[model samples]
Target: MKEKLIQRYSASERINHWIVAVCFVLLAVSGLAFFYPAFFWLTGIFGTPQLARILHPFIGVVMFLGFFIQFFRYWHHNILNREDVKWMKSVKEVLKGNEVGDIGRYNGGQKGMFWVMTLCLLALIGSGIIAWRPYFAIHFPIPVIRIALLVHSASAVALIASIIVHVYAALWVKGTIRAMVEGVVTHAWAKKHHPKWYREMTSKK
Candidate 1:
């Protein structure tokens, strides 16, 4: 039998997602190496410590730009609503292999993660510029630079933690990874997890 599929993402969207994902992993590893004495060995990811230091900020800019594209593209569908609130309250059922609420293209949890990613990215990029090398930091005073460093570190930690959860959830939910990789989801998968969205899609066809 032919497998029924529904489009979940486009080629361009998947490409942009991967660009951000790759840059994020690179940045996370290098950033950790720079932040911790023990993890300094991770500098091998970008060649040497000096190389990692130089490339980390540049990679960060790339990741930020890539995610900015994703942000505008899907932010509308990600808006939270009453259904999202109901989904949140019934999250236990969701974790137990059941889905609740009139879920749309994104679930409540996904929507929350979207906003978290946005805020973290905004903070990281803004503070990163203030603490950046001889180019931008020199424009700011020592105290200001110190604060920016702290803000940058805090936001980095938040983003890293959130991404860890994001990856884990994707793995835990079968077909979730396929949506991002193949830009499609099986009709059954969509119907089961996002019945309202499934109905909308089917109704349009």
Candidate 2:
């Protein structure tokens, strides 16, 4: 039987999600422009190299703040349980597409992504503050500023990689994007992809 689930995401939640997504895309492109000379052409999209340099840090800060809101909203649900640890141990079964029945609300991969992104954001924010030119760096020691530069670059790389995996997972799971876009999943989708969550939601009423 097909059943409609009540809205899981409010209008505010959807707005926040898209805000973060757009900022992320901008940050990724601008960051890449500065990261590689070969990708220098990308800066033209934002105007010039000088403008890209000026805007990158500001864009990064906005994206990180947006991500912080999402992290808080979903952190409770994404917590790792014993089942998640077992799912990680049996990840091979997941790769073979045979462990759908055993997966929980998030599964191990999603939990791992959540944690990794959290750590990366912390690193980026900290390093960015220390390395902020024309502001914070003027008071800090040069050595500290240099270290912060390295940390910022490393964290950005990790975050970009993590987001790539995040995007891939969303696309890999059918109906996943629709859940985010429309803010609701069908009962069949909930039951098939997150049986425990489905049962809990249904049992509540």
- Among all candidates shown, the one with the greatest lDDT: 1
lDDT of candidate 2? Answer: 0.82
Error of 2 at 143 (Å): 1.6
Model 2 residue 38 distance off true place after TM-score fit, in angstroms: 1.1
Encode model 2's per-residue lDDT on 22-100: one tens digit a residue. Answer: 8778778887887789988898867888888788789878878888999999998888888788778887877776554
Pairs with steric clashes in candidate 1: none
Alpha-carbon runs more than 4 Å astray in model 1: none
Query: After superposing candidate 2, which stretches have Cα over 4 Å from the reference?
Result: 1-6, 100-104
Q: Quote model 1's TM-score.
A: 0.98
Q: Considering every candidate listed, which one attains the maximal TM-score? A: 1
